[model samples]
Target: MNTLQKWLGPVLFCTCLGGGLTLGWSATTDLNKKRSSEVAVLQNALYDQECGSCHFAYQPGWLPARSWDKIMTGLKDHFGENATLAAEPQRQLTDWLRVHAADHAQGGKIQKMVRSIPAQATPIRITEIPYFQKEHRKLPLRTWKENPQVRSLSHCATCHPQAKEGSFDEHAVRIPNFGPWKD
Candidate 1:
């Protein structure tokens, strides 16, 4: 075989292999339209259960819908948390969880922007994100309680523009009490 044939052959083979792997990864990604839509609709119904009933459900696609399924199906024994759900209802929750499972989900806005940071670092919440903390670090925690509407992170939408869209985008940030504070 010619020198060009040998060099091009391995490169093409690797590219195809890499592309196939990437396609497979995307196939398993939790952001698929069908599953995400199902999760979006269920999000509202989740509030009907109880306050903190669905804490952080909309924060990030943290858990792949599948992992969400496992968690809900075993709600009564939910890790260390005291959450619970009925068998039939758990089934419904499971179906939704499968699509929005933590494994496949993006945790929060910080995660979306982590590409610019060190991957070895642990993920952080909206309130814990560096840029976020830097901006709101001056505020007192008690201030939030005194004004229920301002309860610390209750106003996440004040900055994360996508909070209304059921997603978080760092570029959309505009901290509340600073600008466009009204949610």
Candidate 2:
């Protein structure tokens, strides 16, 4: 009985270790493939001129076309700020956002965000996406509300210096008042 117990323990440990290694390798491969490419930054002169002037110019791929439409229609009360653009610029920006929306594009976190959302949901804010929320679940509430540099989750660039380039790789994250993120 003693001999059997000793053998069984090592055998079970070996099996579990092998299984964990296989799963970890496969997960890394899948994640690497999905995030290999970065979404193109917002390059439209009008988009940058109007939106970038106020805050970081979020890439259109962050949300779906319906969300963009909702945002454009509500420009008069845009997050409590009146961001009403002229008729022509509004139309152009709306068209640009739609064409590059998450559902219309491929690659990276944007694709994951699109898949995480339900068909009925039309989230105007990137922070409202399930994937974004899941990624931030480890963060303390004070990190978003009390941290002056990271006053809100909408301040993407506060923690993500490469946010402007549409690169949100976890390896690039640097939380303010804290150190590098560990996942």
Candidate 3:
């Protein structure tokens, strides 16, 4: 074969491979950006009223189904408080939470949270998750205890102003007394 004929095949192959790689990389980058932005917002009125009344109505994507199941069943002693609900509403909320728990949730943030948990662990408190601990590890214990506005780490919305909307982006965080977090 002539030099041009022999070179043509390799040139076309390289061009196709480069183009395919670029497209794949672009799609992956977009997906990751979307996933890192936020989680699904809380939509159920019952969940908001019942859970939000006491504490932040955490988005179901924060925990796994097994964790939700355990929490829902033990409402009488929910974090040292009696949050027992009626049978019908309890069942409904349990089902809803199970369907949207981190294990079954969409987005990379939710998946990342799930991955941080051990396989045998069923964490009832979102604060108990390894991902949650790691994220807040930099904060001093005094931040949670001394800050009256943020009495506990469980109070996510206290610092995360957009937490109710399911956005936990660090840039948007505004600690009660500490101001915006840099890390």
Give the Cα lDDT of each candidate.
0.49, 0.85, 0.86
User: TM-score, each model?
Assistant: 0.39, 0.77, 0.78
Residue lDDT tens for model 1, 1-183: 698987998999999999999998888675554344322324546434532444534432433343344445555665466677656665665665455433443334333333322434443333443544554555556445454556656465545666645654345555545543332
On a 0 to 1 TM-score scale, where does candidate 1 land against the true structure? 0.39
Candidate 1 runs further than 4 Å off: 1-60, 65-70, 73-82, 102-155, 180-183
Error of 2 at 92 (Å): 0.8
Evaluated against the true structure, the overall lDDT of model 3 is 0.86
Query: Which 10-residue window in model 3 sums to the lowest lDDT?
Result: 30-39
User: How many residue pairs in model 2 have overlapping backbones?
Assistant: 0
Model 2: per-residue lDDT, tens digit, 1-183? 999997999999999999999999999886666444666665788888999999989888788999999999999999999999999999899999999888855656677788899999888888999998998998887776788778898999898889887787789899988868887
The alpha-carbon deviation from the true structure for residue 166 of candidate 3, after best TM-score superposition, in angstroms, is 0.4
Model 3 lDDT tens row, 1-183: 699999999999999999999999999997657656568775799998988887888888888999999999999998899999999999999999999888865556787789899999998888888988898999886677678888889888888888887878889888887898887
Q: Model 2: which residue pairs collide?
A: none
* Candidate whose TM-score is highest: 3
